[model samples]
Target: MEGLTAQAAIVEAPGGEFTLAAVTIDPPGPEQVRVAIHACGVCHTDMVMRDGGLPIPFPVVLGHEGAGVVEAVGSAVEGIAPGDHVLLSFHSCGRCTACGDHQPGYCDEFVPRNFLGARTVGEGDIRRDGSAVGGNIFGQSAFATSALAHADNVVPIDPALPLALLAPLGCGIQTGAGTVMETLRLQPGQSIAVFGGGAVGLAAVMAARILGASRIAVLDLHPARLDLARDLGATETADAIERLSGPFDHIVDTTGVPALVERAIDLLAPRGTLALVGAYPPGGAISIDPAAVMSVGRRVVGVVEGGIDPRRFIPRLIDHYRAGELPLEKLVRTYRFAEIERAFAASSEGSVVKPVLVMPAVS
Candidate 1:
């Protein structure tokens, strides 16, 4: 599949519309693999990249939560083969201290590896009209018919599972569940308050249930999303402005709002943990009461990708889904790859929970 032509959703400028157009994809470099993507999940992260929040160059292909089949493996890659089904997550340098310690999310080069437009170590592979376009937007750039992905970012999955439904396990789902299961390690009968009730928050709610948490509350402005959170194992739903006095063991702020963060910290119990997993715009800051934190021994921590290795954690998520414990399907809303603009609209309007873009059927 050398010199293959592919269609990708290209963002030409900040705030520009996504244009589905033909582009040239280079052969995989050594230690890379070429994937024929079956499905890609649209995330708020994609919107951030498109709107210049992370400041990558224009004309970039952006989609991180991707699931596909390996069509070509670079000579140096191993274990993964051309026919293997796979899910694409964030890229990390395997040799970093964080990676060596099994926390690739905290890799030293996270921003350069995933957010920067170019490949982490070499030249990018996407070209349009003979000029370079950002191809490695989270190492997969799977808003396309195919993507050139680093082998380190591609996690093989069971071929029997529906690739489309499993695409989101790469990011949003993993982040939420990982935050609850791995980061907080919420115990049975513990209490957790998850703010925002979006995909990440709902995933946390589901995870809290799986971990046997006794009190799980989800807050959101959208009544529908709060209801969905309740359906996904939230014990209670509340409005964003309605602050509850809580001695909660953990509070997760996925809203990324400074106000909500302050409230979440205020609600924490003695020795409680506050996990911040939301993405705020650059320069955003949250203020918490230092005296209270010191007095109560409250701990506030920022998390990335739920603080778990995707290779190990994603399979656990799949097992939860298979056992009907995760109920991730309740959060999905699918769209055609060509309908990415509409999908963005749906996401922005809060009309869909998690929009999955289905690529064109490969013959």
Candidate 2:
């Protein structure tokens, strides 16, 4: 399938618009798989990359939360083949110590492999007018009708599930739920406070509810999102963290606001854990008193991709969705692939909790 033509949304410069263009996809390498993307979730991280918040280069394709069907597989690929349904997540080097320890999210080569926007520093797999275009962001660069992904970043899933609905499990949903279920390991009858009522925070709320949390409080500035948080199993919703009283057994901060993280530290109960899943801006820092944290035995841990292996955690989330425990419908809003700009707008305005872009079907 070398030199296959596909439609892709490309960002030509920092803070530039997403222009739909004809690009050519290269054949998969020995450890790569090509996917025909069905749906891709618009995440805040995508916006960050677009606005040059990260170190990724320009003229890049950016979409990490993608779900699709396998279009082709490389010679060395196993357990995945053409015609399989799959979810695309971040890339990780399988030989890293973190991967060997079952924590691929912390893989040593995470930055270059996932954020460099190319297979290597200067080479990209997709081309437009014979010039290399950045295409391997998150190992998938899936803002296109089709994408080439590393075998390790592609997780085959049950075909019965709707790709549009399951797209977010690749990133946002997994980060939120994984932080609660795996990182903090929240126990039943415990109390939790989730800061920021966006998709990630709302997901944490739902996970806490699934764990039988005694009290779940969600803090967000938007009333609509706060209301949605309540419907998703939050026992309390407030526009500000100050409005909620807490000695919370666990707290998840998805806002990435340094102030909110500082406030969350004070809310934790003794020996309680506070998981930070939101991405802070480059060189961002927060001030905290060591005495306060140590005196209460509070723990502050940073999490990436929920500190989980997608192969193991994504399927579990799917099962929860199947059982009616994770009500994804309440959070997702679909847009046609051509409406990519509008989808990003909706996500930025908080009008949509999770915006999924559906690709046009192949003729």
**Which candidate has the top score in lDDT?**
2
C-alpha lDDT score of every prediction, in listed order: 0.89, 0.90
Angstrom error of the Cα, residue 23, model 2: value is 0.2
Question: Which stretches in model 2 have alpha-carbon errors above 4 Å?
Answer: 118-124
Clashing pairs in 1: none
**Reference-based TM-score of each model:** 0.98, 0.98
Runs in model 1 lying further than 4 Å from the true structure: 120-124
Please, what's the RMSD in Å of model 1? 1.2
